[model samples]
Every structure is written in C-alpha cells, then in structure tokens.
Target: MRMFDVCIIGGGPAGLKAAIAAGSQGLSVVLMDDADHLGGQLVKQTHMFFGSEQQRAGARGVNIAKELVEQVTSLVNVEVVLCTTALGLYDDLVLTYETEGSYRKLSAKKFIVATGASERMLTFPGNDLPGVYGAGAVQTLMNVYGVKPGNRVLMVGAGNIGLIVSYQLLQAGVEVIAIVEGGPSIGGYLVHASKVRRAGVPILTSHTIKEAVGVNCVEGAIVCELDSQWQPKSGTEQRIDADVICLAVGLSPLTDILWQAECEMVFVPELGGNVAYRDSTMCTSKPHIYVAGDVAGVEEASSAMVEGELAGLCAAKSLGVSGAHLTLQITSARSQLEELRSGPVGDKIRAGLLQAHR
Candidate 1:
C-alpha cells in the first residue's frame, strides 16, 4: 500500500476542497473518486449556485469544480485518482480501492471521506419500468450525457430535488406535466417551487403517484390526492399523460465506508438518512478519520465544501501541525459555515447540529 499524508475519498466539491487545502499545507494529498472524472454531482449540475459572494454564488458547479481542480493541480502536492471506488476502510486507516480493472490500497495518516450522497428510492406499482428514474438520473441523462430522459415527465416529491429537477426538465426542452407532492405543501424552498410554477407547471400538493402506467418503458403515470395519513382520497384519482416518471423523494448519505470504518452514527432524516456522528471539528468516533460533505449528511454543495475545508484544517491540526495559517483558515471557515447554518431553511440544519452536539 502506498502512503500519503492525506487521502480524500470522493472527488466532488468536498473532496476536491479537502485535497487542495491539505496540499496547500505542504502535505502530500490524494483524491480518489469512483467516477472517471472529478466534480461528483457538480458536473451533472447545470444551474447556478445560491450563496454569498465568498461562496461563489451565481457560479455554475461545473465551472467551480473545474477551477478548483486546476488550482489544486498547480499546487503539485495533490494527486487525483479517477475511476477509483473505495472498497472499504481497513485497520490502521488503510483503505482498499479499485481503479480501472485493478485493485489498489493506500494508507493515510489522516483521512477525509466526502463520498457524498445518493438519491432516495421509492417503490410503487410498475415503477420498475425503464422510463421511471431518479431525479439524479434525469439530471445525469440531460445535463451530462445530452440525452433526454423523456419528452413528457411526471415529477414525484415536492422537495428541492423534485422542484429542481422539474425545472431542469423544462430547461431540457421536455414537458413537465405535473409535480405531485405527497405532503400538504412543497417540501423544498418556495423560490424553487415558484420558479416551476411560473413556468406553467402545476404543483399538486397533498398528492402522490399511485402507479407508473407502462408496459416496457414509461408511457403515463397515475396520481391521486392523499389524506393526512397518506391514504388515497376517493374521486381524486387522476392520470398524468407522461412518458417518464422522475422520483425525487429525497437523498440518503452514502456511508458504507464510514460504517466499515466503525464510526458511530444516528438516523437523522433531515440530514439525509443514516449519518456518522461527528464533533465540532468534523472528526468521527474513530481517530485519524474524518467525515464531511453528504457522506456525513445531505446538505447543499456549498455546505459540503465548507465542511470539507473545516475537516481538512481539523485533520491537519490533529497531525500536530501548528501555524497561524491553519488557525486563520479554520476560524474563517467556521464563521462561514455558521452563516450557512442560519436563515429560515438553515434553522432546521442548525437545530440538528445543536441536537448532535448535545
């Protein structure tokens, strides 16, 4: 196994930031990702990011990832490994991984996992059809591969993923027939919902998909109003003329490695499924191992990047590094992260953190 001062798993925004931060500190760093390219979900994202100027607000995720990668490469201390899937975390902070057709291993004095999150799945009658897909799948098909998921779409779920994907479907020149929300109102930001509505899309609140109606590929969808208990309301059943049904129920943290690393966890639904417990410094129960990004919990990419920076600083400090540079970096990063945990949407996140700290 090769050894490095720092090794980051997951090459998305968080992992990329971690590798850059560590490398800038004179540490030899490696960023490993399962995808053939860097930028995790960012590459599939074609929308502008929302955040403060310091957070690169209004900039596209693809542009941000490209710029970050370029800067990190110039540092010379960072090596990026693509098409690398982390097998598991072994004893003594050793990590097993796969790249191309070969197996590899690496040991890190300090490790950061920013593997990110995966889309949540929901099962319904006939949902196994080829045209039924996750919101991320729709995004991947349209934005990355330049392929349309379908011409007419029925979006399930009212959260950010659902709303955002609905809008992206329109952007891809597809017709979004309706967005069915199982809850009373939209589960995501009002701004995103408003954007969808302004584009002539109807958001059917307190509604759900009864089944995806198709034989081989998706041909249509069955939707109905739901009561408080989620039971279908009689006389309200309707069929949406659609070729694809995109499910955007939510996201779940991809935490297989964290679990293999033996980190303590809690099932926090708001933070996105099962997550590893971390301290203020983002260090998990296991020493020398850190968790950040969606692998820690599901949040915006901006939040993921901030946590990645903090994790890098904390990991560096844990390795007995002392300098004004690290102090300044961490202090600034913490303050920025604190701001992101404020605001209306952020209040729930902040409350979760308070509970976690407790």
Candidate 2:
C-alpha cells in the first residue's frame, strides 16, 4: 500500500485546486482521476465562465484547466495518478482503486472526494436509440473530439447545458431545431438562453420530449406542451425532424465512495440528488474525509474550486499544517463561496446547501 498525507479522488477543477492547496502546504498528496487526464469536464467546456476576477471570470474553461494542471504538476509534493478508479473507501482510511486491470490500496491521513456529477438521463420512448446523447457526451463529441453530433439536433431541457450546447452546435455548423423544457420558464442563465435564441433556435417552455421517433436511431422527436401539473397535454404532440436528441435535464452527485465510507447523505432536490452532508469547510461527517465539487452539491465550477480549496486547507490544517497564510486563504475561500452564492441566480443552490449542510 502506498501512503500519503492526503489523497484526492478526482482531478477536475475541485480536485486540482485541492491538491494545489494541500501540496503547497508541504503535505505529500496523491491526486487520482479515473480519466486518462486531469481537468475533468473543464477540458470539454469552450465557453467563458461567469464569476469575479478572482475566479478567473472571462477565462475559458479549457484555459483555466490548463493553468490549474500546470500548477499541480509543478508541485513536487503532489503526485498525479490518472486512469485510476476508486472502488471503495474503508473505515481505516484506506482506499481501494483499480488501475490497469489491477487492484491497489492507498492510505492517507486525510481524503478529499471531488468526484463530480453524472448527467441525468430523461426517460422517453426510443431514448435508447443510437443518436441519443447526454449533454456532456455532446460537449465531448464536439468540443473535445471536434466531431459534429448530427446535422439537425433536438435539444431537451433549457438549462445552461442545453442552451450552451445548442449554441455550440450552431457554431459547429449543426442545425438546432428547438429547445424544450418541462418547466414554465427557462432554467439557464439568460445570457446563454439569449445567445441560442438569437441563433433562431426556439426555446419552448412548459414543453417536453414525449418520444424519439426512429427505428434504429433518432430520426425525429415527439415534443408536447405540459400542463400545470407537468403532465403532457393531449393533442399538443408535434414531431420534430432531427437526427440527434440531446438530453441535458440535470445532474446527480456521484457519491458512491461517500456512501461506502458511511458518511451521512441527504437528498436535496435543488442540489440535484443525494449528496454527502458537509460543513462549510467541506468536511463530511467523517472527520478525516472531505467532499467538494458536485459530490458535495451540484453547483458551478467556480464554487467547486473554492470548496476544493477550503477542503484542502482544512484537511491540511487537521494534519498539523498551520500558518497565518493558510488561515487567510481559508477565510478568503469561504468569503468567495458566500459571494458566489449570494445572488438571485444562486437561489436554488443556496437552498440546496441549506439542506445539505450539517
């Protein structure tokens, strides 16, 4: 078994920041990610982020990922392990993982779980067809691999992912037919929604995809209006011609390791789904275990980075690394988080955190 002062189970924005904080404090850190590379979803995002300048507002996510990765790699105290999947977290502070068809174990004085969220799939007829893709899948297909998902696309959900992808599809020279949302109003930032709308893609509120019309793959989609109860209104179904149906409904926290560790979990709808209960410091019920990013709650990457810094600072502090700089950094991180979650746009996330915090 390998031993380290800290083990971070993700390499996304959160995990990367966590490793930087802990490693900068002179702690031996191991940052492991299931993917072959670090940066997580940040590498797939092509749009500029929204936040204060301190959070790198106006910077593209891919650029941010590059900067963070550079910082992490330069830290000699931090080890980067890729293509490693954490299987379980034991009570003895040992984590089991699989890499290259072999099982391995590692123990750390403190652990930070930054495993992000998975895209939620919508249940509809023919949703299992070949052309059906998740929002993340679409981003990866276009932004990462530079492949057009299809010529014409029917986007499901009007959230940030849906709106952003719709615009991305247009930029990729694909035709987006329309964006359908079950809610009465758009769910994403107005700026994103306006961009797609300006591209001549209609956003249908109080509407949903009833089915994906196809034999072996998506040939079209059946969309309809929804009533106050969110039930589909009869006679409102309309067929849309498209080869791809992208689902961007929502995301649920990936907390399997937290569950295995026996950390207290709660289902907060606003936060997406079941998430580990954590304090402001991002520490879970288990003293030595911490969570950040979507695993703690589904929020933007900006907040995830702050939460990651907080978790790493607290974890290092718990491990006897202390100084005025560390204290100031922790305080700044907490304040940044609060500022990020203080607006009308953060209402849902603020409510979710209320129910998720210990």
Candidate 3:
C-alpha cells in the first residue's frame, strides 16, 4: 500500500487545483483520474469561461485545463496517475483503485474528492436508441475525438449544456433543428440563449420531448408544449426530423466514494442530487475527508477550482503545514464561492445549500 499526505480522487480543474495548492504547501500529494487525459469536462468545453482574471475568464476551458495540467506536472511534490479508477474509499482513509489491470490501495491523511458530475439522461419511447446521447457524450465525441455527433440534432433542455451544445453543433456544421426546454424560460444565461438565437435556432420554452422515433437509431423526435404543471398538451405535439436526440437536461454529482465513505449526504435538488455536506473549507462531516467541485455541489468550474484550493489548503493545515498566507487563501476562496452562489440566478442554489447544512 502506498501512502501520501493527500490523495485527490480526480484530475479535473478542482482536483488539479487541489493538488497544486497542497503540494505547493509542502504536502505529498497524488492525484488520480480514470481518463487517460487529465482534464475532465474542461477538455470538451470549446467556449470561453466566465469569471475574473484569477479564474481565467475569457479563456477557453480547454486552454485553462491545459495550463492547470502543465502547472501540476511541474510540481515535484505532486504525482499524477491517469487511467486509474478509484473503486472505493475504505476505512482509515484507504482508497482502493484499479490501474493498468492491477488493484492497488493507498492511505492518505487527507482525501479530497473532486470526482465532478455526470450528465443526467432522459427516458422516452426510443431513449435506448443508438443515436441518443447525453450532451457531454456529444461534446466529447465532437470536441475531444474530432468526430461528428450527427448530421442533424434535436436538443432537449435549454439549460447551459443544451444551449452551449446547440451552438457548438452549429459551429461544427451540424444542423440543430431546435432546442426544447421544459422550463418557462431558458435555464442558462440569456447571453448564451441570444447567441444561439442569432444562429437561427429556435428556443421552445415550456416544451419537452415526448418521444424519440426510430427503429435501430434516432431518426426523428416528438416535441410538445407543457402546461404550468409540466404536463404535455395533447394537440401541441410536433414532429422534428433529426438523426440525433441529445439530452442536456442536467447533471448529478458523482458522489459514490463519498457515499461509500459514509460522509453526511444531503439531497439538494438545486445542486443536483445527494451531495456531501461540506463546510466553507470544503471539509465534510468526516474530518479527514473533504469534497470539492461538483461532488460538493454542481457549481461552475470557476467555483469548483476555488473550492478545491480551499480544501487543499485546509488539508495541508490539518497536517501541521501552515503559513501566514494560509488564512488569507482560505478567506479569499470562501468569499469567491459565496459571491458566485449569490444573485438572482443562484436563488435555488442558496436554498439548496441552506437545506444541506440544516
């Protein structure tokens, strides 16, 4: 069994930032990721991110992820293990993972879980068809693999994923027939909605996909208007001819390790699903274990990186590694996170957080 001062269970923006922060503070850190590439969803994000300069605002996510990976690789105290799946978090902070056809266990004084989140799928009549895929899957295929998702697509959900993906599809020469949302208004930022609209794609609010039509794959889709209660109107059904059905409904935090670790879990619909109850420092109810990124709550990448740095600093401090700047770092990170979680758009997130800590 290998041991370290800190073991981060992901290699995304959050996990990478956590490793960099803790390792810079003189802690032995090891970061693991199941994917061969280090950047999680960041690699597939072609659009520029939002936030201040410190958060790399105006920079593409792929570029941001590349910069983070380069910084982490240059650190002597931090180790990066790719293509490794962390199977479980066992007693005494032991993490069991599978790597290169072998199983290994590592124990750490502090474990930071930044496993992120996965796309939420929808079930319809032909949901199991071959051409049906999550927004992330389509992004990965088009952006990462340099392959097209489909020639024409019908997108479900008008949230960030749905809107951003519709624009991306258009950029890639794919015809986005339209975007259907179950909500009364677009769930994502209006700026994104405007961009998609200018591209000539229609945004249908209070609408949803009733069924996908195809035998072996997605050949078309059925969309309809919904009432205030989200029930479909019978005569409002419209058939759309498309080869792909993309579901960008939402995401759920990947908290399996947290669940297996027996941390305090709370259901926060605003933040996704059941997430680990974390304090401002990102420390869960289990003192030695911490959570960041979407595992704590489904916030944006900017907040995730800040949460990760805070958690890393806290982990290092818990091990007796400290400096005058440590307190300032924690304070700044917390402030940024709070600022991000405020405002009209963050109302639901605030409510969910309050319920989680309660």
lDDT of 2 by residue, 1-358 (tens): 8899999999999999999999999999999999999999999878999999988999999999999999999999999999999999987989999999999999998999999999998898899999999999999999989999999999999989899989999999999999999999999999999999988999999999999999988999999999999999999999999999999999999988899899999999999899988887788899889999988888999999988989999999999988899999999999999999999989999999999898
Q: List the residue pairs that clash in candidate 3.
A: none
Candidate 1 C-alpha error for residue 170, in Å = 1.0
In candidate 2, stretches whose alpha carbon ends up further than 4 angstroms from where it belongs are: none
Give Cα distance to truth, residue 188, candidate 1, Å. 1.9
Root-mean-square deviation of every model: 1.3, 0.8, 1.0
Tell me which of candidates 1 and 2 scores higher on lDDT: 2
Q: For model 3, how does the per-residue alpha-carbon lDDT over 1-358 read when each residue is reduced to its tens digit?
A: 7889999999998998999999989889999999999989899888999978878999999999999999999999898999999998876788899999998889999999999998898878989998999999999999999899899899999988899999999999999999999999999989999999999999999999999998888999999999999999889998999999999999999998889899989888988999988876778889889998888888889888888998899999899987789988878888887888788887887888887663
User: What's the residue-level lDDT of 124 in candidate 1?
Assistant: 86
Off by over 4 Å in 3: none
The positional error of residue 353 in candidate 1, measured at the CA in angstroms, is 2.4
lDDT of each: 0.86, 0.94, 0.90
Candidate that scores best on TM-score: 2
